[model samples]
Target: MMRRFEDARILMYSHDTFGLGHLRRCRTIAHSLVEDYRGLNILIISGATIAGAFDYRARVDFVKIPSVIKLRNGEYTSLEKHIDLHETLKMRQSIIRHTAETFEPDIFIVDKEPMGLRGEVEETLAYLKTRGTTLVLGLREVMDAPHLLDAEWKRNDVMRKIGQYYDRIWVYGPPDFYDPLVGLDVPPAVRSKMDFVGFLQRSVSHDHGDDHRPSGDYILVTTGGGGDGAELIHDVIHAYQQDPTLTHRALMVLGPYMPAKQRRKLVRKGSKIPYIEVIEFDNRMEELIAGAKAVVAMGGYNTYCEILSFDKPALIVPRIVPRQEQLIRAQRAAELGLIDMLLPEESADPLRFAAALKALPSRNPPSVNAKGLRLEGLPNISRIVGDWIDGRGGKEPLRVIKR
Candidate 1:
């Protein structure tokens, strides 16, 4: 843990179970750190199979472990490798432990999962704690509902690990919008270490460069990773199919993880509609979003950030089963006038989607009220990390600022 300020090393763990949120969030943080602090090295340990597809900045790198996906039954399975869940988790556990010991980073930031998948990061957390590493846990603005989150955390013994191993907990969103730990019976001990660092603002550069921009006005529809988004995609496409008189052109990015056959089926369906275009994936999604007349998406953390970053008017169709995190976020944001959302039942009806689509052109942009929301989380995170480097962290609670 002892190191020259200029030589400080940061290691982040992102358990990318089913989506790109964790990896993208960590990458933004890692890039911000190294960019702000000269010679600060950051290494991310991720389970993202598409890790190489991203463009990482200088001084930021990653170690990709075997991937896993969370199933609808609340169990994890190997993403691609033939091994069973137990073997996959064991392999991941070993890789994490070895990386922590060998990397010996001054600051260790664990993304979302306190103990990682199946507690794979337990050994690493324990190891780094004994070494006096500056340990932190990065969280999204909203986890699931309070009762669900409390029960799950309790079952997983998350609070204890948080109390024992982490020096600080950074919630990457504004408290004014949502208090992530509220109603979870977060002990005073853990609460004291919590900081609402505001939302991590994504760069507009990722929105799109000239080359990737769409040639014509279009409504951009995307499901973060496209695995569980089949229903949403289907509804949207069906809406377009049912409403031939729809004026706006739509470009759909079927997430890479969507079953190939399903993607092909969607592609075929889209081919019949002149107004609809379908693609597999785009690393530069922000570009597409930036150029869109309006945005339609699932309510993943990263997607929300991108939508807010561009201040686009968005129609959020969030998933409800398996996890309610996205639905919770979408609902809250809608209530706050940051975006609009269709209920599960409503999104399932093509007629309703068609109705929503027809009104998209007249909808107000999120920027109308997004001005009051905090989007400086990336810079604030860098400041907080700098404070830690200077031994000045934990001196003050990051208060909620009402914008």
Candidate 2:
């Protein structure tokens, strides 16, 4: 199809308080949308401190908001020590509203958090709703444990707000994988708006511009954003140390948010292992994943998508604290034979982890095990956006998938 809608605008929100997962997912979606349509421009509002480290496509850009960090205990505070949390939230809310007012987007896509971090985007959502914008709520394939998720949402009237503001809710996974809103009091009105769009596929950039990208056979170990990744990284290193027979070359990306002391400690330890290579961070993770023989990760949403996108053998060591989202995803994928999983406790057993790591490369890839797997989210989303812009949208009824 020829490029159309030269003046169309899209605004995306990624309340990136904890990890790189949110920003990376939004970036991939934004890039895919622009490629699908000509003359379309997308602006992402991100709270990640390293949002600008990423490369954006021609028509996609981002606005960085004041950073607020979400601690492991589920409390929020300003990333800057001197700034008050309330003050930071106020600034973020103000900037988000101002950007929406100026950008005047035809569509507003909010990632995960309905009201955004601490309801910072509530005003923006309301303003956009008044302007007749197509408001969308994008959710990961799996959310936290249903009970935990329910309590969190119950604290605020999140379900009500989502029903009121969003015209559509896109689950970035297939219907068979998981339902993000399971065990919640979802009204029929809100349930009808859901579209199970499958997983967002990833691809290496056209330019192999990064000289640091790995070459040859190696297991890629990553903790997305490295905020809470120290344990996983340590476990991997311990596995290498425990068994000298595990000689597969490993490249570990410590992630950007990892504390410097822990990063330094891990780097120092991993360096002593002949087959282990540690890099602080790399923005072009897709390229590295593509080059790897297998993958070891904490099973964040973005990494899982990339593992499937690249069809690499994967071992998922999912985090269970603060949120069980990753653990849920890992367990489900394991059940489907898409990937292998180890609890944090299991991974700490160096011998057990080393054995898992050694066996990783030969394990069958996701494509072979999960014939029903899908990675059509990007294209489907593009089509949906086009339909909405081209006068073809109303809540076209879709099956309200249940757990």
Candidate 3:
């Protein structure tokens, strides 16, 4: 039997360390939950560098964990403290377990990662399962391709783990376009627990407010985390330099983790351009994107959602290595006529990059058959979550209008 939303206490976990995507998505969902269930009390477990920047309702609270980052060599390390990786992970696990035990939430929502911060959630899930707490895994719309996903699943035993432990799997994207579980060989029983809740993105209000807009036509270049974005940034600068006639000014946001030396070099180089502005980081990305004519961004899920939500023409350069998830998302979005994708090989040529940017205006804006593709998923997702809590089966699939 489902519990009641207004009277329920929810525990949400988002282990965001490198970039703002996970943290932002989790916050959006939490906000939606609060809006739908007026009296909902949400406790967010996040490790984002910018957690304190968000303003939450009185019923919402957060536990900020130690931040961590993924190294180029595929290793995870702490961002703030210089502790050993193993020790840091262990400490994180302890905190997660302690939080779950103390709070005694009715439902537990784990975002992106199933094992939580370095497999921390595993301990919590075990404890919760024994204590009769509902466990749900919230996955982004797109994961990597079949081969990569298979390898990852096998290595992590994600399929088996989910089958045994989770009560529900909520995908934040439409299955009609891309079903994340398509080729995974999941059991029928496990599949029954899956729900495609559409894309969970923050809604854009008509009142964009008085955010500073660039004087002339300018391209916004951003990588959620500057760690893997240096190459993309370099290529954009090179592309602009190659063609002096590139009319648009460039605004590059070297994300928080971008090394000081690298940032200084980019700043110096951008100063020479006379048409470029560089900032270390800006929390108000939605406003910045709203004001831009076009966007050149790394193909992270959150950024893709933002571009679609704003109806802005975009040229996405998805990172290939480490995880092909971003590349897969870019390709899918391009296939759907939503955005343009420029692969790494194509981005190697300055002319190619220039051409992609120049052709942005021709691409069609994102559209849905229902409600005109206005990004209605946040509210609907919240409603469904509330219904489930209210002891409503929530068996019906949320309707989504495809373009």
Separate clash counts for every candidate: 1, 0, 1
lDDT of 3 by residue, 119-221 (tens): 7889899998888777889888777777877787788888888888888788888766577766678788777778777776655433446545557666789
Off by over 4 Å in 3: 1-7, 204-217, 368-374, 392-403
lDDT of each: 0.84, 0.90, 0.76
lDDT of 2: 0.90
Candidate 1 Cα misplacement greater than 4 A, ranges? 1-5, 206-210, 392-403
Question: Compared with the true structure, what per-residue lDDT tens digits does model 1 show for residues 233-348?
Answer: 88888898887778689999998778888888888888888888888899888778888888999989988888888878899998887778898899899998888899878987
Can you give the TM-score per candidate against the true fold?
0.94, 0.97, 0.89
Scored by Cα lDDT, where does model 1 land?
0.84
For candidate 3, report its TM-score: 0.89
**Candidate 1 TM-score to native:** 0.94
Quote the positional error of residue 204 for candidate 3 in Å: 4.4
- Model 2 C-alpha lDDT per residue in residues 306-357, reported as the tens digit of each score: 9999999999999999899999999999999999999999999999999999
Q: Write out the backbone clash pairs for model 2.
A: none
